[model samples]
Target: MKIDLDRSKEPSLREQICAGIAERIRSGLLQPGEQLPSVRQLAQDLGVSLMTAVQAYGLLEKRGLVESVQGRGTFVRERAIATEASGDPFGWQLAIGDYLPRASFWSQSAVRLPPEILDLATASIHHSLLPLPLLEASIQSALKQAPQSLGRYAPFQGDPEFLAVVAGYLQRQGLSLSTHQLIITNGTQQGIDLFARTFLGPNDVLAMEAPAFSGAIDAFRLSHGHIVPVPVDREGIRLEILEDLSLQMRIKAIYVVPTYQNPTGSVMSLQRRKALIDFAVAAGALILEDEPHRELTLADKGTGRLPPPLKALDPDGRVVYLKGFSKFLFPGLRLGVLAADGALYRRLLAAKSIVDLGSPLWLQKALVPFFQNPQLPRYIDRLNSILLQRSRQVADTLSRRLSPAIRWQRPQGGMHLWVTLPPFLDADSLLPEAHRRGIHFLPGSIFYPGEPESNHLRICWTNLADAELPGALECLCDVLNEAVR
Candidate 1:
């Protein structure tokens, strides 16, 4: 085989060689069970080191493009060549079939955007809002004080000091959790995955909010859990329906985002929270309460007091609380906490150990000081203030620009405004035109467990600066107008 290596390219020589052979295998140029040159022979022919050729072959073998025999030489794997020779290049897809779940729209839409496009889909804080100086300082402090953290893996459960800090943080929010009840996760996504895999089984019934977090839906589906969608109003999920469903079906779990729920920024009422806990207790069903944006809320206009999470009200340890730090803080941190008790905690901790051994110790250590700092609350306050301003801008712009064509309730807190368009208009159909006009949003269809409502869409206001909102809204308005016309 003739192999060409570009030394000027970004990929290493080993990667280039591997890619060349893999390409040939995929194109049917390499036949099934066809022997490849020995590592030394390949090295001599390609003018590369024997070790480099070995590494290339090793990667190809790992990729199933090639196989190595004890006495025989490396050959293209039969499956790879057979797949290529079938003339259907996508035959491998049929091998996996529908068993491989499709990614949620939220995940697929999370791509790098052109600099000029208005971003109204991302569920993250802007880089400018991140506490860079504090983070740098924290990293330095962690290295100085707990340099040993970098040398080894953290305990499977989590670092004790980090867990203690997390417990204290949760305590301030009125949910008193012990360190033993907590499992440090890579992020809330992993926590959701762990719960789905550990507590749920194939065809198990999982009750969920109708328009829920796409990631949660994806996780439950991947675990082969059947979803029963309960509708959500401005007051959050309709618990009466949930109660009825629980009574009729054997639900293994109920997942909720009580505080500042995704897509729709609705917070569950206090009455509903208590009722949910009571229902779960009666039904012997677990509640997976995702609270990534719990701390983020626009200041209440009147009472100024927000309802505590369902976890705090849970009397029977029926709630597994997941709190993600990546939303409001640095996204790169990928740190979150899962709080459960008794058998639930043990299972989740064991699952976490199997998933990633444990979260990085240095990162956990660095965050301890960051969370403990007195200025942390102030930082959050500052962030909320900015978000509140942007939220208002989006609402006002929508009202003035789009008017009767669009309807939505202003969120009490959180970054998203779930807007409903005219029944005749499809949000998915309008996305390409909107994109052309330098704007983008998440179509509401992705958030549903059943048939998606094509007229609804979610718009986020936290990622852009205040100056960018008006123009973005204008672009969105123009697109909506054209669509209706």
Candidate 2:
């Protein structure tokens, strides 16, 4: 086996050599039980010291990738076998390195909890608040009108009718787009994955908000792109930092959740949106604008209309916009629209075809009438009313129950409240007690791409029933209070 070591690289010779061997084994280039070169031989081949070769092998052994017996050379370990006593029978699969990306933190946090536990971590609306009657009527009407959609596969781009509906819907929101520019995705997450597969390559620089969505972090990581985190404030991502970094290294794409940003519900100012577009044009970079929570506006009419989306401001077609309904509407519908143009649009459509043929034709058919329903806007307004009340209750409770050291700003929209703790307190360390008290929250570290800030957590105020909310808030506050004491 050949192990290439670059002395000029940041990794030490020992680490490079170790990683090379481990990759070879995982990729099946080195068969199980194959004998490895002797340490002296490896050193001589690679022109490294014998001590370095020994250290490399030691690291591989520690990783369970190799084993050495007395009076014999090192050999690759055989696949882990299941035994009656072992807890994990599928452990052997770990070494295969098939390389499917998993969002471990998101998966672990989203596990099914007991009925007694209040799920403050779930960023979804309560069932009672959903427009059940309206949705039922729409689905029944769709079944009567388009029964044949169930038998036929949807077009690779999307259902033509659904595309037309979504195009019109976006036009009302200030994003004028034609039917051909839109593709129906299963959800925004899938749209993000499509972008990653279509545009991102290894070592491509992706600049995103520091405390961004956890799922996006995982999706971008799957592309093996080097993510650069830019801090967010009341105005959204700090462009100055991104501009400075661009000078240091080429940034291929910028990802943002501009309006009603996830975790922290800050909106990017209109001027900032324009500036961002300008920057993208000047730098020749693409902007991936994710607007999943924009429609859940909780502010009063006095707050005026929200800023137009980044795509609305872009005349250069540099922005790829993704709008999802799963957050505020029917989550089971798993519906969203992605708008793009030019070569990137064609590539994304091709990627979607490979991903799932198309997002479910029947569901797309159901959404057409729902999108056209006259009562839809009123229903959204009603949802915001109840959500506003719940958000206020949460903010007021935190103000009264939490220490001044613990802080959070009342969000204008969206389900989550980004809470910051004193620097000495770590949110992850407090999670177990939070769970024991029958409440759950998402630790802030999951939202960050690298070197997370441990002093923050995200709590959603929308998932609990109105009656369960006060008690849930009390339980959450009690954990924080006790921790502070």
Candidate 3:
């Protein structure tokens, strides 16, 4: 058999050889029961190493393309050759059967809605709030400054200039981190996934708030980590339960959204934040602090200053902080930063490299100038002002319309309000009716890792226009009233 190998191709020599043999097998050029050349002979013929030939054949065997018999030869696997003739186009899907159920549920939750419906489920702000013109100018400026960014992959850690700007920005927020301690991610979701993949393994315990972010739950689940639900109250995650769980199990990591947490807009109190850091440090466990809504906090109402982040309180290298810009800025931008120090950062960087090589360099370049500008804080303050108004509007509507039946705290900041219905009313059961009335919301059940609370739900107030809020809230109130009756 004559096999030609391209010395200068993008794929390595071993991969190329494997592809060549696999292609031949699939095309009937190498028939079933046909023996291929021995590793030594193939190595000699291709002028490659013996290990390269062995790896190629090994890859083909792993791919079910070939089988090696004792003292016989490496022959094409009959089953692999016959897969095409089997006439079942969907057979490949069987390999992913275990994952499909969870995937389906996630997709259902992410279903797109028609324009007529009021979207109270999505976490993103309306397009009108985003600085599209400013972003476009930033992109153009980035292209002019670093045109090669579009053509090449960014460093595994992130772009240096972007990282420097992010480091400076974070430093100003009371959490001082060098560029070396940071890694840019596609979003906070990717940052969560990287942390899970880096630290968690099958049956390794992961402690998170009971009603945590669904995306983080999915990420840890996919990594096969055992989830220990630590309940959260109006203040934040229950620290006593976390301490108990850590004592009982070798807790690998603790995930939290300390400030204006998703779905539930609860902020972690200063005492809890300090205690959490203490627990994590004592247990030698990492704290994956997801702070996407940190900047969206409403203006202080004589509450003094908000407590510093867990990372800020951490004297040890235990906190891995993740911050995202998508929620406040534009969802399509998909920009986020992950900060950690020493070995944890190195491990996370390695995991990130394996996940997607690196996040987009051009996007990072575009965000650098935007982030570095001194006036960015003023822009964020304006954005938060709008969000604060919307949040209060939602709280007011709920209080006026639903009254004592539905209970929720008026979020000081952030986009969502966590609402608890009367005991007899189930949020999931009410979802279809709400959707029918051109309203959409997320049931709180999806956030729980174990048994879900049926009477709880999350409503996002940032997506709808000012005029649309009252009607939507009225429709939701109608649904609740009907359910109670």
Candidate that scores best on lDDT: 2
RMSD of each: 13.7, 6.1, 13.6
Which stretches in model 2 have alpha-carbon errors above 4 Å?
A: 1-88, 100-102
Q: Alpha-carbon error at 341 in model 1, in Å?
A: 0.4
Candidates sorted by lDDT, descending order?
A: 2, 1, 3
lDDT of 3 by residue, 1-485 (tens): 34445576557899878865664554344557666788998898779999999999999999788998767668788754332234567634422313211221264455788888898888888888777777888899999999999899999989999999988988878888889899999999999989988889766888888788877776776675667788999889998788777667798888899898877888889988888888887898888999988778886546567799889888978899999988888899888999998998999999999999999999999998888766688778788878777777766777777857678888867788888888877787787788899999887777776456779988888888878988998898888778877
Candidate 3, 445: how far from true, in Å?
0.6
Query: Model 1's lDDT to the true fold?
Result: 0.82
Clashing pairs in 1: none
lDDT for each residue of candidate 1 in 1-485, tens digit (9 for 90 to 100): 45545576557999978866764554344557676788998898779999999999999999778888766678778754332344656634422213324356435465567888889888788888888988899999999999999999999989999999999999998888899899999999999999999988765889999899987877776685667899998778898798778767798899999888888888888988888888888888899999998778887446567899888898978899999998889778999999998998998989999999999999999988998999988998888888877777777887887857578878888788888888988887788788888989888877887556779888888877767878888888888767766
lDDT of 2 at 223: 86
State each candidate's clash count. 0, 0, 0
Better of 1 and 2 by TM-score: 2
Give the clashing pairs for model 2: none
Report the lDDT of model 1 for residue 161. Answer: 94
